[model samples]
Target chain A: MRVDYRPRRVSSAIAVLAAAGSVAALATVSEQYLAVGISLAGVLVLAFGAAVYRRGLRVLGVPIALVGVAVGFAGFGVGVSLVGVYDRSFTYTGELIGLLGLPFIALGVLPVHRRLSRRLVSLGFAFLVLGVVFTGAVNGTGPDPIPLLLGIVAAIVAWDAGEQAINLGDQLGSDARTWPAELSHSGGTAVFGGLSVGTGLVMFNADITGLPLESLLLLLGAALVLMVALYK
Target chain B: MSNATADTTTKARATNTDAATDADAATDAEVETATSSSYGQRVSTDADGDDLVVEGERRRTGRWRGIVAVALFASAVGVLANTPFLLLATVPVAAYAAYPRLTGSPSATLAVERVIDDDTPDRGDDVEVTVRITNTGRWPLTDVRFVDGVPPMLAVREGSPRHATFLWPGTTTEFSYTVGAEYGRHQFDPVTALLRDVSGGTELEAEVDCDPATVLTCTDAVPEVPLRKQTRHSTGRLVTDDGGAGIEFHRTREYQKGDPMSRIDWKRYAKTGQLTTVEFREERAATIVLLVDARPSAYRASAEGEPHGLAYNLAGAEQLLTALGETRDYVGLAAIGREFCWLAAGVGLEHELTARELLATHPVLSTVPPDEDPTDPDEQAAELRKRLSGDAQVVLLSPLGDEYITSLALSLEASGHPVTVVSPDVTSDATVGSRLAGVDRENRISSLRQAEIPVVDWTVDEPLGTTIVNSTEVMD
Candidate 1:
């Protein structure tokens, strides 16, 4: 509860963004049969949100655009990466999340006001982080997927917060002036992922120090996330 | 406020043609330009009895003209070429045609406000010029150009009219220029731009509609040196001051019986009216031909980060005439660079106006090369000296730049005319180069002093006015 609001916000934004990216990548993993619908939904949602930011109106259009685009690639990359590891239905979940994620991003861009946006942003952040922690507990440390998930979430928070706060002075957008918020809610994905892997390694293996490996990897992820959000 | 601004800009371009027509050759030049859309509407507006707003814009006209020309040409070429590429070109053509209607300078969006004009500069003073421009446009701009226009007579070759800046939408930029002062008018010309496309093909030319009639004027004041310094006479000014009436103390003359009671210096009369009353010597100055020596040898060192010494002398002379313009003094400005520069002295507003016109003006070719045995003013002054002797004062503003001119100053002083040498001294103990230059400057300075001429040894480091006030106070 006492955790810095800005950091938490960054963590949440990054978590959501990372989750969406993961979902986007996984959308096609459902293989051709299930991939199309989920991918299309995600891309359509994203584009519609951007459209709204540009033209101002119609939140639904972005989801439609995100779905079309995300699905258009159709489970190809995901199928190649995951093979048969994940259940095909995961793509549907990924699709649904991306769809939901689009509106939040658009709203983030457009600003629906404090009460609604804050609740949704915070709640979403909690779910992703919890999911990462739970995954880490189950999995043996080092390279645990849970920390990876959390890092993505943290990255999203950093970028979204930047978009929300900075107008770049010359344009209508103001997320972060030059850097992502120090709190880096979006970085939550990287943190959760790192912690999960780190703790899992400690829990399972006694010889290696989870602290160094987890910290180093997570630090690397955090740096990468900050660059993505700020360099542009 | 927006409406007021638009209206003012419109009015500036809409000067009365008839009034302009009656003006002299100067007005003739204006009349020729008056026919342009930028002007000539004042007479029509008054004649029509129409109270309609004068609508005009800086960018709109340019855009529309280009758009119209391009659209018509593109359409014709599209039909003639009958190719898909030409058809593709049609999109750019259409964009051009639509741009004038859709994209504009958004007079209301961007702003050119809070214009602050410095006090009128004398002929020689350097005045600060500041202009603030804001971007009220929708897009981000990488470069903005600000052009500050002065009267044609004052245009010099060395400076630029534009200073570059960047402005994002809603961001403001301020531009400034510092140039030597001259006479006549200096106006704020409308802003213009060549905006590059994101794709980098077509350039969007935008011009802001603004008032160009804004006038900046400066007069000259008489050169104030010490009492020992003599004044030189020029054919340009009429120097004799008769007893019309003035404030400066004149002289004690035999008292006439019916002299006005007011003419009697009460304090002096109280002591001795029987002896006579004080007649304020008719306070007047001769037309002073300012002959500045601007050769390479005459070049003097300036304080760090400042212009050369000769520049200060030039500015000083201009200011003197501008101040003198305020009084009854007639002042003419002359300079001896490679060639002798001359300004005829005149009276009242005309004299001040002429000096201002000259100070801000620079000769197209400033250097007097050694090979070119140019006609020096000292030689010319010698000829004019005999006729104008006992009449005009010659104020020479120089870096004392060279030896020949230094001797020229002495010779002029020896010629029975009061001469004031304004030396924008370039020598300094502070300069390493000066240390090696061997009191060359000191010797020249002393030589001018030996002639018993009043010398205003000005440094670019300190203001000429400080030296002037100090020197003149001793004389007074």
Candidate 2:
């Protein structure tokens, strides 16, 4: 049997994305009964994508991953329309959605294809958003947006950390001497994760009383600073 | 007249000494200075000077940018939806964006000291290398990652040469690793050091210079090689063609006036009723030259981690030389490469040492093979013919990986030197190319054997002694 062992970056990225996609789909399905079909389809597509990617059929794997994303969005729309029948509390629904993305977060972090893994992470976050937003829209009382936003932030951080870890693993695979540099880089990224969680908690409690125009101007300034800081 | 001659000799000796001193100074200067380039950076300095410093540009990976954009989008959505919770999502994004300000840029004042347990090691010996990195700058480095550049050819035997740690001002950290030495001069690759901020947003990569290189010499003291059935016209252990006064009897000849009493052949004389003398087959020393094929084509290995065919041929040549030397036969050394290397045939302790040094340290048989062939086949063969004595036999050590080698062997045989090939098999059946190469090699070996040249097909899996014994038995 021909094993499709791709470059370290490609394989790790693919694995991460597939895992994240699975988690996102599971989260959406648990929020609404109507979303079960879409979740199943997303899961099926991602699983196939992983299989084909491992088989060295990258051309087929990517398309399958994309199809899963489409299925996930379709499921979100269907779940929103049928959310009235399910009378679960917003907190329970929100917690389940948050918990559902965990498996995908774990999977997304696996060393696979870097690009595909990133895409899977985005898809997973999309599924979480879809579930929370639809449940809120149908219930006429949206879930606590703070917790939902926190979950999205956590997913993004996980994806970033996973990417760094996979990249380090690739470096280590090529040369053991690269471990020091890779480990240091990984440690630096880990600090970001802690900072992100801390900032989220602080922002959840802080009250910002300012004029709308002033707030918009402040946000624009912050965006410009962020762009400048992150510019390569 | 004696005084004048002595004065002239003294003046000449003084001038020669001055020239010798000047030459030694030039060579010392060259040895003291070394320069190397890695990762697009060039470093040049005296060997005893402070280590060369290479600095890289600070670059951002743009990871936090995506989160920042998402935060901005969420804020906009929050304003429209009148949800404060949506706006709160931007907190982590803004914090990550500003995290770089908490840490300073990586310091350039980093020193690397590399120490090896053995600078000159024997082949296959493990050498332990310790690299100590010190932070000389005032700022405390939050995250410093370094990988000691080990040569690609050497295999790490134990431990790791990489480390990730935090170093304060005037602090030092070290990592140690062991690598198995192979025959050749191996230069350590520059140590790659990467400095990052606490947020991992910015990176500064640099290559640090350490020690120059390590040299490994493979030595052969005694090698037991099986001899072929056919022996040349030589007075040695091998029985030869002509009859002379020796232990092995040839025939009974008519007794001459000067015949020795011990060789009178009394049993033959008693039976024939006539005086007779015993004659034995003549045994004389044979002049043999061992030629190792160090051509670019012969530098191939069957597997990635295995030594190339040239290495095997070198070892085989050493064994043959040792075996031949034991029998008190005149043995010489020659290499077929870009440049022809030849040593005159002689027998003695001094000559053996010279042969071993030539085989081990000759530039032609370097660890890494040269890219281009400097000498053509005709020129190489002509040089070999010119160097070899009229009665000297040739022992050609080659992989027969290419057609040119077969032709070269044939040319040597045609030039009146009896050629015995001890080809080290370096082809495998792993891939399609390798399988085809194996077939090509087999064909070449068969063609050489068909041309009346005695070929010892040596497989790497078997010992040289065993292979030579089997080939000799087959020839007999």
Candidate 3:
């Protein structure tokens, strides 16, 4: 009945490895899309692990979300860096990653407390929406673009650092071995299972992702309940 | 031994050591100890009635880590079915189930000990009682209450039971209460204690026999006015004629002035030289008898403020025994209501001491010996009827409510046994406003008056001196 508030253990080594894997997954998947979205499942697993394990969430959430946004942005940051052979489409620096999308993933699910994480994530989401609105207003690029882009980079870095700090916090406990596992699992879910799924669905449905968000989310939720009821 | 308040420290240590050992030895099987049975199973009967007891249930698991299981499931589902936030709603629901946070094991002993500071009490006298509850188990006691069974013969109201919030293994909690007492030797059969477990869903019961101890001591109603003259052959300050040594004259005789200075009769010498000074002697009572009662009805229950006649009568018996015992007089005892209860009369403090001890130690209901001489009653009546062989004084100890005793008192008077009725007050009905008690009182007093037996009605409130001073027979 009494909450054991004592600091718990953390696995620093596992956390670093999880963060590296999440970023690497997003980078490789961005360049090499497999159409079926099986890589999306990997992202989801990492996200779910982060959310469930206290330390895992803190370690993996920011890195995975930031990496996904970074991958999306890398395609946009360079002009004509990628020209699809299928349609000879022009890939612009801001268009592919969508200057604002990465910010949402980086900032949304990384805070220690749920409310703060939600607020920060929502604000980032709002910025992304603004980017779309601004892009439509200016017909593509804003007046002061570098600072805005740097601001995007700064936001992602801040979120990643915050996630690392929370997951590796002395406050959660000095238990080195337990913390990394807790942070990686919990942080990974808050992002991949939590935010990444939102981004992936939103992108898929909103032409931003070229897929359906609600239907995809519904299928995932239903599948979840069935899997647990059957397997667990 | 470690002086820990509730044996918690000892239990903690034992739990650390014993549980580890047990866990290693019986890793697969759960062991149930001797203290596992609940209190309801400990009930047993005694002379008074069935002793009361206390009892409860318990159950333990590794389900605490299951809280995180939701996330892993949520993730797999999110990828397969495409939903991500489904688990957010199930967050708070994951904290259910009963889990033991207890660190150690408790000892297997639950003991109940009751100590009556004083078992014998005078009516309206305060007596202290203590009940100690000990938990020998290593577990912490959540809630516990102890109840003491008081005999109905004693006028006791339900007092607050003591609570031992925590009784660790090898630890005890002693609870005490101050209770007012009435006369008579009341018995304490068994002590009952109920204890609860950490979860409070289970309980424990324990009952232990505690030897009876006196709580309220009702001494004889002490007489206020000191008697100036001691009874003949009775031990006291009174001077008597049949004595071994005396400063007073028993006879007068003619004597010469030349006799020893101490023996010379100065008045006789001045008048006629015939030294005829009277010789003085000390007086003493020949025999003294104390009559007590042990009839089944004599031990009937009475009111709270006013006890039954038996308690008062016993109190009076105590006083008379003390007074007579002090004078070094031959004292005899008789229980009027029951079978032959008279003890052979003897002299000195030892005799009265024996009688006092007999009354003090006697229970309300004493079984009549089957071996009594078949003719002792009639023979005793005949013996009482014989003249008091020269100034034997008799102290009749009674509630003065029995009719048969009054007739016996008259016969004793006729037999020349000078009798003093020393009654202990059983006067709840003296005012008549009390209807039920009044009828019983009226019948009792009438029987004494018609028989011409001197009666002393003792009231609990008034001192014994008032009864003696108000007696018309004693003044005469």
Candidate 2 at B92: error in angstroms? Answer: 12
Candidate 1 TM-score, C-alpha based = 0.38
What is candidate 3's lDDT per residue for B1-476, written digit by digit as tens? 11221222223212111211223323212212211333112211232111122232232223222323433443343334432222221221121111112222222245555556555556677666666656655565544434555443344343333333445556767656556564433444345454433322233455544322223445544443233233654434456655334566676655545545665667777888565544457655446676664444344324433355565566566666666566655666666443444556676654554555455434322322223323334555554445234455566766545455556666776666766666554545444544444466566655655655556665555656556667644545
Tell me the TM-score that candidate 3 gets on chain A alone: 0.29
- Candidate 1 Cα misplacement greater than 4 A, ranges: A1-232, B1-114, B117-287, B296-304, B326-329, B362-390, B426-430, B436-438, B459-465, B473-476
- lDDT against the true structure, each candidate: 0.44, 0.61, 0.42
| DockQ, all models | 0.02, 0.19, 0.01
The lowest-lDDT stretch of 10 consecutive residues in candidate 3 chain A is A1-10
RMSD of each: 21.0, 11.6, 25.3
- Order of quality (lDDT): 2, 1, 3
Per the 3 Å backbone cut-off, how many clashing residue pairs does candidate 3 have? 90
Candidate 1's residue-wise lDDT over B1-476, tens digit each?
A: 22322322233323322211233565445444534543212122122211111223333222123223333343344334332222222233333233324322322234443243454677656555555556655775543434444333233333334444445677766655455565434433344443422111223444443322334555433344332223333221222344434566656677788876777667766676464666653434554566665565554444442345555555566556555565544555565555544555557664454444444434412221345555555665554454443546677777765577677777766766567877766666676777554377667777777777778776544556677887667545
Best by lDDT: 2
